[model samples]
Target: MSLADSPIRHPDTASRPLMTRRGWWLVGMNILIPGSAQVLAGDRRLGRFGLGATLVLWVVLVAAIVTWFAAPTVIYTIASNSVALWVVALGLVFYGVLWLVLTLDTLRLVRLVRTQPSARVPIAALTVLVLVVASGGAAYGAYLATTASGFLSSVFAAGPSEPPVDGRYNILLLGADTGPDREGTRPDSMTVASIDAETGQAVLIGLPRNLEDIHFPSDSPMAAAYPNGYGTEQGCLVDVCLLNSIYTEVEQVTPELYPDAAARNSTPGIEAMRDAASGVTGLTIQYFVLIDMQGFEALIDALGGVEITVEERLPIGGDENLQNVDGWVEAGTQRMNGYTALWYARSRYSATDYDRMQRQRVLQEAILRQFTPANVLTKFQAVAEAGAETVRTDIPQSMLGYFVDLAGKTRQLPIQSVELTPETGIEPAYPDWDAVHALIQDAIATATAEPTPAESAAG
Candidate 1:
């Protein structure tokens, strides 16, 4: 019937006109099984709707839990897609409002004015507590979903996808180090991640920032400028005109190098770096991810920290020599904050850049492996905010779902790395560009090769 016509008077409590014992029982029943009090007493139709909604929600929740167990990658895919997240948020708000309405209606059926004065406070408090527990959880979930959706939209682009070349998708990863003191943007750390399209097998090809005379593709805009190699036309110092300088040299000094770079929603620097990377790796670079190292420390901090073993003591900060040592990281296994980890991955005060390159690779893998499902869910907002500031890429947002799924598969497989260093081969000063490309191609070939039956069993 009507809310005003609630059955406040009970025949069982007729002996006591102002007794609240029956009121407590009905409210408790409503809290335990929403709308149960109405089902047993007043408004059976409303009670049925509440009960049906609860059952459907429980079923959906159970299915989602089961899917998480059976195929977690599916969950990641759904989580990354903005459309899916919006739908989930709407669903949560719908269920939350339904439950809230039922609970409030149940409170109306209690008819607090007819209950004993002494029991009124406790009954009201319990009802409010129940409302908060049931509705607040769903509200929080909806907020989280909306936050993730906005994050995905703001961070990734909507560009069209590029097909893989020769069974592999090569992504250029650049860590651009730029600041007030620095002359221009220079991607200090560069690597090419070549992943198999069908299988998730992958190899990381590390390119030293100091590699000299980096060649560009034949048809590249830069090919005509430095026919022999980079730095030939620039007339810059050996230390200044390294592989990483290609970015700054093009963007600041020679913006006219790539005429259509701006139209492509890219910078002359990034396009130049991509071409140089392709020439070095002998692979068609499909996309590029530029990580702002200055802001990237925040992401590492959000992830708590990274742990690594130090083979020797290294100074935290110094010029090119150890004359001005800021601090020292003692040798051993230790966990470090973002600032310390940055130094650990890049310290070259008393060591070689090759040493730093190796450390950087280890640090990269360690941070990636740190991502577990539990931590990601709990600290999602923090991670997303830090990521927005840390990454700029040409990878399409439409491909985020596919990339998330691919990441899951990649996590399950082994990752191999090939570093071009002094120990490995020719000198960086007078290097053989052809040899470096061959090494990268061989690494990709070995990474994509199918394992024999005997090898598979052994593995």
Candidate 2:
């Protein structure tokens, strides 16, 4: 039916016809459903196209949104969170563009109805298609923006708080940059954190795995003691865990058995290693986190990039380093992605193990910075998904809420870290097992002993 042929008109609304009830309906739909307004105002073709186009665009936008949160991570959440802002801004721009376009098209429809009323049906259809497609795209884009927005709203609903515990606690954070090198299933990087519950102060103690001859738990009885092998509860130290030896044993397994060789390497029969490590360090272990390498990279990519200070400059080695595909970077405080940070933390050959420990600290700080409310709101789902995919932790989900609540309550607490490496003149290989045991005992004694007022005031 043609607009001029059919009789769907409003009485007493002829003059200034474009502002009439029917005309306004067309404009409103143009704003709300894109082509539907035009189709109602006699634009068939446009309506059909707009509807189809809208569906397609919606599918695409929703897919991106889902992927972001499906495997969330701190890095992904930080990076993807910014997308909400971009989505809202772009959506507004799109709305403006659509409004201008539809307004002009509305005028064209009016002219068609008056001049060639016979052409109304065809013109209306075509207009409908155009409006439908454009509006659909806009609507779908909006859905994405809305979904992303809601994510941020929930995560930043409150401010940072304090922890439940009220004393000093130590947690070992392991980032297994699981890759080509490693033995047995064990962590790639281990970070020991001493948190003062009373003061909300934190200390990260970095320990190297390759310091050769530190006391570790031995399977045999003789090795269990200091004389034959590093023995006694306090004899074992970080050096006792042989990285190369552990790596070699784990490498024998086919990739299938350990699909994520790097991620799972530190996981195979971790009980022995953990027990041994606990005995060696004398620090009561509380919690542990293991992060996936690739997922970790995706998260960093999502966060835009983490800013960190390069303690020292180190060149990227040749192609021999499979993971150095991103090439070398200079030493200085600069932005880094998951890949770069992973390399920096794992670059044992390029620099001393001690240096790597420092880099790990830098990465840890960067992680905390990336978790700001603004950042979390932008990438909540994505980061959450990434963390789930690439990371595993002994801290159960039930307890996690408590930790988060506690952290939120606490103000920005001071952060400190310590490292027990061979550089400290604690070579496990040269010294007798007895010496190593004594060292572990001494470390435990110092860690457990209450600090005097003078020492506490120094900081």
Candidate 3:
């Protein structure tokens, strides 16, 4: 029969309403199906081709599903079978694209129906292609969600453990800018995070980066190392002795190359600083997290900016020593991104590192306030991803889940921040190990004694 001479059966010609209804019903299904609509519209060739395409699409979909489940072993060649997280993100994108294509195909089919004698083959082929893509995308999206859940479960497996100290735990959170970029390598900022797991009370202690005469846990044989001192005054002397020696030694060793080696270099320099701080604080360091400035900035931005009080008026571009990256910022109760916030917290140009340390303490408090439900809801994924990239710690991967849970529960609590600097106490010319030990002992004792509920509220 000639294509023009072919009979076109209208649904109105059917004797029973059910029979006529079958055509419209088939058309509706065909809108999203491969070739069903074409068959109802009297296109046999299209119906046959559509069925074949449907079968092929289903087969491919099943194969993809199987591959998705086997992702952990396949993608990483790891022994354990695990789903890949990135696969999930890709699946979401695919689903969105597929949905758009399917929607367009439906519109095309509707347009074809407007023709006097619907040419079903063309529309049917298009519908089949759309269905195949959409169905595949949907299947992939489901697979990705499953895989991503598994990946997240693996990511936050670590939890906070009981510190050696009876009830209170000391966490050393260090922000170091000493990675690939070499942006800045000032251990200029440090936080001694003390959490009373029992009482749910927390205290963050900040220390000035340039507090002269602080103790150092040195491996240098030239410096006189004092392990223990007799009294608080003697302890101060020991710390003084150590810092003076470190400054002298760093100056002596390749003076031009190792000018700031006592503080800048990550290996022995940073490590020894940690040890010295630990010795002085008397807080058994339970956990330590070190992050570079890039990661630090990313985290602040992800958290949607932290809230800080304007302690003193800060004008931009005053200090030549800070170089160009810093000193170009005004200070106030301002919302700061990671970079700007870092500058604010690490600004040591105008005043001593002591002033910067106070800023750091205030910023930490600001962070606790900013990391609210509203903040997390708005930027949870961003913050999480940024944190994963920035932070380096000794905490095991397995306990991250516990830490996350702890963080969530205590995120809203008011942060009590304090800075131990020369302004608060005396700085000896030589290392006074005994005095430093006493200071740490008093702080820990005060922190551990469970405060009255009213006292907690007052603080």
Candidate 4:
């Protein structure tokens, strides 16, 4: 047809005023409210579908928030459910795809109204680029959620433990060693971490591994076997009554003592140790997380090692009795790899268990400080894998979200620690339970209180 004399006119090809601005407006509308752009562009059917999908998403999100606040157990149950996680992962994928399609459709509407061909090409390309980035981010988030759900399911048990009487969660942190020379895994390091539910202030009460005359709660199985105190009635040596020996002794002699615990907990020996620790510390141990010492090196390596101040030369490899130091870590503040850090925590060459206990606490604090979010994100996969392998706990997966929130609070609070040692008037051979309890209570009180100028300065 001749240019100006053509009788036929293209209805869809008509040049519209503010075409470029309208195209940009459609992009903005799609970004803010997914379907509104389609509706404004006269695509009622597609717009209705998009609006319905968005409504469903908002409803699900609101329900999750309500459930998290009202009934956290339900959220935990959902998080622990493998099928639920799979369904959520699939739903996220669908949402991502739909979002990408809607973005492209919005750009198409822009093209329909666009008068300049050159402008349309760049606008469409830019719209696709933005949608691709957003969709990619959503997909990555979904992947991380799936990985976390799986890791939680693998490491933590399903059932919940009762909270302590003082409105705090007392978790027993046990470092278990399962060497070939030993009959069974023994708790080499035992500490009760009493955490305030509201403030996240924590008090670490360290129990010396060689503490003798270990008391057992009246209701505990150990008490039933040895009413006078573990190893006291048997007339065995003090080493038989050491606090750390309770785990191996119980596992060897009475593995079936706590049948109920077997339902939610895998290690009955650790449960026995928890009771003994509870008896001595005067604080109920709600849950226990046992870290396999052999796997601990891998976990530290996964976290890219930890930085700590070494006050003495620590030995790495030695005989079964921890004698004849083959390798020594020099005394200094330095970043240690997994093997050196593990030795720094476990070494007992010329040092006693009490000294080792203090070193362990320092190593723990260093790990907490170094395992920052930036470091975690950088090596998430390795950390997740190592953590799953190293730790076995009775803490349910449902409580993880709450614990994560509590951890955020803990980062703002000071950690108070009390170690039962000879310097603190605590005799491992004849530990006074009353004095130990008072020390722990004092630490907890100090941690929960607002810091004074002197306390802040000292800290």
Best by TM-score: 1
Per-candidate local distance difference test: 0.79, 0.53, 0.53, 0.78
TM-score of each: 0.85, 0.51, 0.55, 0.78
What tens digits encode model 1's per-residue C-alpha lDDT throughout 132-196? 98889889999999999988877776668888899878999998887556866788899898888
Better of 3 and 4 by TM-score: 4
Per-residue CA lDDT of model 4 for 1-459, tens digit only, reads 542332111224455545766777778888777887776674768878888888898899999999877866567556556667778878888878888988988877776444476677677777877798767867876786688678877887778546556779998999988656666678888888888887677788888887887778889987888788777667432246678888876677677887776787566787888899899898888888899887899888998889999998877778667676678899999999888988898887658778999999888777765676558757877878888889988887667656765665666667788899988889888888889888888888777787734568899
Candidate 3 per-residue lDDT over residues 221-295, each given as its tens digit: 222343332122344322333332332233333244223333322234344445545655656666666676667
lDDT of 2 by residue, 1-459 (tens): 665543332222343443333444555555566556455555567665555545555786687677645632333433334354466647655654655465466755454444344445655665566566655656655655565554444322222332434365556676655555633345567666656554434556665665334344444222333433332345333334353333323234222323332342234324333433444455565555656665778778777778877766665544444355446666788888777866676666566667877877878866774556567557755765565567655553334334543343232544455566565555634544355446544543454454534467896
Which ten-residue region of model 4 has the weakest summed lDDT? 3-12
Whole-model lDDT, model 4:
0.78
Question: What C-alpha RMSD separates each model from the true structure?
Answer: 4.1, 11.7, 10.7, 6.0
Ranking 3 against 4 by lDDT, winner: 4
